[model samples]
Target: MAEETDHESKTEAATERRVREAIEKGDIPFSREAPVFASTLGLLIALALFARGQASQLARDFAPLLDDPRGFALETGGDAMLLLSRVALAAGRFLLPILLILAVCSLTASLLQNLPRFVLDRIQPKWSRVSPMAGLSRIFGTSGQVEFLKSLVKFLSVSVVALLLLRSERTRAVNAMFVDPSQLPELILTVSIRLVSAVAIATIVIVAGDLVWARLRWQRSLRMSRQDIKDEHKQTEGDPSVKARLRSLAQDRARNRMLANVDRATVVIANPTHFAVALRYEPSENPAPLVLAKGQDLIALRIRAIAEEKGIAVIEDKPLARSLYDAVQVDQTIPAEFYRAVAQILFFLFARAR
Candidate 1:
């Protein structure tokens, strides 16, 4: 029990990936009451529109048997079968529209709750589902208790609604009791319509409430653990620490390569201590001076030390060194905006060499 509690505590709000995976597995929030409500409402509407017509058609179909029972007798068995088939076909035709309405309502309710998606996993057999212990636990669990309470509430509420509706029409019922038997059917139909309509309306309200509650419960169930969220992030964006380490290694390799290129540069310009930029110029091979390497602070100190060791000219030009380091990249030709400044520096160096 303590382990179970700890596991439950680890889970928090579900991540998008978790929710999407659950959807793919056919795990979705749904309220069974939604379809029942839709079907009941549709049935009530269908009855209101076609009940009288259906009753008249039924009376017509059965009237022959009632008026002249001897006429149904036939010499051949096939004739009797044909007569029965015709009656059955007529009944089916009459009820087809109502059945269609109920079917459409059920489908619409299902679609609204969770849009259609084909997932064969939902239909696949699972041994755990068939386990007797699991079945018993499900029947005696928290969900079962909630279902039982809901059933009891529905029964009591419908009973109260029915009693109220019947009491309201008691006077008419009493009057109808004394009327001709033929009038009794009409009176009963009227009372039934009122009772059913009230019940459907009440059920719809209950179903709406249940749908909200069910959705909240489903969301809670999908909550994920902190570790699960981190794992998903690593899968999608990679582990942050690993990425940082790789970046540091890449920077080190680039810096080593840059230091090696300092030997090929014609001059190393420095801000004395804070900045360093090594420039290479070959008038025959290139039109403008190229930045061979650049670095700042500690790296700048290392660049100056390497230049001194290699016997390369190290010029301390604060503004030029700072501008080169900020604006130019290694292996890139100096920009046109810095052309005059770079040209003067190169010319001065050539004169000094001559």
Candidate 2:
């Protein structure tokens, strides 16, 4: 009941991060029946194409030993060993193609559903994997029950197919026993082709249904709650509090650098208590005077104090101080629009210096 409630609570689709992490952990929708179906298909193909030829070849190769047993004698260990080697080589030659076909088909089936990825976490030892409760939960879980139903369906379908084929060919099967030894291979190949083809046809439906079910279950498992999305957003972007704190620290460092440069100002414009803008001018250095520093309120007071300690000139012009602080940036030339107001200030300061 609690599990169902939890499942219901997760209404949102899985975020990209969640999906990526799941894949990194080797969690993917894979149909077990697909590989089984592929192996069956491989068997059917090999039986149809290669089985008749190989069986005949093997039969011909063994004809001497089987047809006239008295002609061959294993008198010594060397003779026995040689005979065993020949048998092994012949069996391997007959079976190698079938084995290769099965392997390729199985791999292709798996790759069609999900690409391969190596994840150590998948193979790592985990207590939950071996836990009794976990094992039982898996066995009795809805997913397990669904799998059981699928397996039951596949088994019944394949069994019915086998039974029907056997019933229909019961006479032929009995008569096969009495056939010539050389003809036995062809008869066996015919029966195998029929049985494998029937089984393959019957299980195709089960495999297709299982593939869809597996994908649905995997997607359902990935569903996230609203809170989960919020938490992931914080992790991927950044926490609000931490970002604010970082912004604060950056502003403080910039202010300190500005104050340190205030000592180099030729003059400081101030509202006496609220605003300050420090300007530095030299005919050879820049086309217009550059503001060395500007600030309001507490920062303005700090800039003024720094100027006073360095013995730099402080001019009180409440209106001009406000405008300069609004429009000017430290280390940047004052705007051309402010040229008249600022040139007048420099003229008065230069006259006072003389």
Candidate 3:
């Protein structure tokens, strides 16, 4: 009841992240009926291809014993052991091919549905696996009820197929009873193959339906509540407060780095106290003057103070300072349009030094 209530609360379809996580955790939709259907089909194929030859070989091996049971003596332990080994070998030959076919078909069926992955969580022991309540809930749950209904339908359908095949072959079956015992294996193989082929055809519809059902059930199980989506978003994108703090910290670090580059400036263009643009120029190193730092107001005053302390030239040019501060970025070249204005400042400072 609690589980059902929880399931009902998940009204929204799961997000891509939710689906991906579910798959990583080894939660995937798999239809048990797919493998059953494949094995049943494999059984039919085995009966058609191999059963006839094996059964004939088996019958031939056992014919002498069946024809004259009293003539073959089992008087000693050695005689009994010899007979037993022969019987075992003949039985193995008849059954081994069919068993192999079933095994291959079952494996292929499973692989077609889901890729193989080793998930430790699936193998780990859990309390729910041993709990009586859990076991009972699983046995009587929606999935269990559906499985029961499907199995009942499959059994009835297979039975009907067998009955119909038997009805059609009644004459041949009766005639085989009076025919040579050696020919009985062939007669039985024909009927078995026909019955399995009919049943296999019937199972095709059931398997296709079950595959669709399993996928829908799995998707429904992965559905999320509105709260669940919000929580998942937070976990994926992180807390808003924390993101803001991080952005602030990054800005502070960049500002400090820009301020530290003030001492390397060849010229500091200042709009008195309103703006400052510190530039470094070397014709050999770069084609244009690089803006080392730019700031406004208090930061402008700080840049001017740092320029005085480092003995770098500071020229008050309101138009150039404001334009460079707006147009240039730290650690980037000034535009060609500002080249003449900045070059005039550089020439004046160099001439004074000379």
Candidate 4:
């Protein structure tokens, strides 16, 4: 039963369950990309933009270097070793900010998702890792199909944006060659902004779609089978056989206890077919006589067994036994109306004893 119950629990725990739980709790993320991915993407974009800005500044600053012989000499390098060092230092300085930003953003993303949970399952080796056949299968799997579609869409989207930008600025770009250089920066910024915005919007939409897909999958995984619910109910309520055994044990214990006290009972009254009750009197203390034991069917047989074992007289009083069983509980005094009827039975018992 335990094993069956465990299997049922496992079956009910599908990926969809997690998605449903997340949705119910409002714990689902806005996009499929974890904080780390979002931060990394943001950092990469920021860095790229910074790099472009820095390159522009460098071009504007060093624009006059080409006109001056000494400045040109300094830019080109007089000392071979020093020139290489300078160029390396300049490259590092230009790129370092973006690299640092990306690293920080990546860390921030990881932090948002709760850093370094370090689940061993993620690091474990599997047949898929070593199997070329499996790798090929996965590549042609549903996941691969989705990836292929995504790539195709991305390529088309980027191409469309690129064409639009080039088409819109074609005349200005050609005309800017002889025009004031100020117009050139404005044009470049406008084109870059439009392209970046389009790409960013596309990326957001794709990521959002992926998140939705994941949520759907999670919900599907959580679905419970009919068998699973039934098994869980059995596990929680206990097995039918065990419950029956427990009930039998309880009856046996009660019978034993009642039989042990039967020798002290004053009278055993019976409905003959259905109910039986035993009553005892302690006139020295109790205000009224109390019922010693009561039961129906097999329990009535058990009451008779105890009474016969103890040599207590069992009277086949059908009406009195049934009334007492219905109106009174074990260890309680009989009601007033039943008292007069019971007195007559006690008088008869005493007359027989004499």
For every model shown, the clashing-pair count is 0, 0, 0, 11
Summarize candidate 1's per-residue lDDT along 179-217 as a digit string, tens digits: 765555457767878888999877776798889878887
lDDT of 3: 0.92
Pick the winner on lDDT between candidates 3 and 4. 3
1-354: candidate 2 lDDT, tens digit per residue: 998888889999998899999999999999999999999999999989997899999888887878997776699999889888888888888899999999999999999999999999999999999999999999999988998898889889989999999999999989988888888778888988999999999999988899999899899899999989989999999998999999999999998899899988888999989999999998789999999899999989998898899998889999999999888877899999888988888899889999
Q: Highest TM-score, which number? A: 1
Quote the lDDT for 29 in model 2: 91
* Candidate 2 to truth, TM: 0.81
RMSD of each: 3.1, 3.6, 3.4, 6.8
Candidates sorted by TM-score, best first: 1, 3, 2, 4
Model 2 segments beyond 4 Å from truth?
1-5, 62-90, 259-264, 268-276, 284-287, 296-327
Per-residue CA lDDT of candidate 4, range 42-147, in tens? 6557645685676566446444543453653444335666655656766676668777776777677656544344445546888888899888866897656766
| lDDT scores in order | 0.85, 0.91, 0.92, 0.70
The pairs that clash in candidate 3 are: none
Better of 2 and 3 by TM-score: 3
Per-candidate TM-scores read 0.86, 0.81, 0.84, 0.65
Number of the predicted model whose lDDT against the real structure is largest = 3
- Candidate 1, residue 331: Cα displacement in angstroms equals 3.0
Lowest-sum lDDT 10-residue window in model 4: 28-37
